[model samples]
Target: MTTTIEILNPTFARVSGQELRKAPFPRLEEGTKVRIGFLNNQKPNTQELLALVESGLREHYQVESRTFFKGDAAHPAPPEVIEELSRFADVAVLATAD
Candidate 1:
């Protein structure tokens, strides 16, 4: 008797040829206080991970952090949430910890 097995791939690839572009963020001056915005992906342990990062930043630099939940990890964040973060933070971090 012979047995057959099938393997499935659950990976995503970019099929388009268009290259991505992004503007470089400005450098911060020395002694400047930094405000970091955290976008939680609503995944397991994502909040804990962000908390640790926030703690580290606060210990080493003059940092302020604000966290916003994105409701669903599989969807994009709401425009209002992005706008609020943009107004309050100099840099943003979107974390996903499963």
Candidate 2:
């Protein structure tokens, strides 16, 4: 009598995927009437940073801006917040600081 052992083979299959692409963001134009959104994640110094940016944009560009503060910096801004910003503002500026 003879005993036989089965051999198992392992293989890696490629996942269904496409090539990664660069992020798509709208360009801010000068001398154009636009609305900008400033997002504060509630982190320390983030509000101050955004405030500076807000004033600078106002001074340099012909644009309008609105600020939205996220309750917690640890968590991402919710979809509703993003949707509202998209609807209300032409572009968003997210700021974080240590």
Per-model lDDT: 0.83, 0.78
TM-score of each: 0.70, 0.69
Global lDDT of model 2: 0.78
**Candidate 1, lDDT over the whole model:** 0.83
Clashing pairs in 2: none
Tell me the tens digit of each residue's lDDT in model 2 across 1-98.
Answer: 89998766467567679888976676766666778898889877787888788788877578788888776887878888888887888778864745
lDDT value, residue 16 of candidate 2: 72
Error of 1 at 72 (Å): 0.9
9-96, model 1: which lDDT tens digit per residue? Answer: 5685767987788955647765568999999997878888889998887776688889998989988889899999989988889556
Q: Please state every model's RMSD to the true fold in angstroms.
A: 5.8, 6.7
Q: Which stretches of candidate 1 lie over 4 Å from their true place?
A: 1-19, 29-31, 95-98
Off by over 4 Å in 2: 1-18, 95-98
TM-score, structure 1 vs. true: 0.70
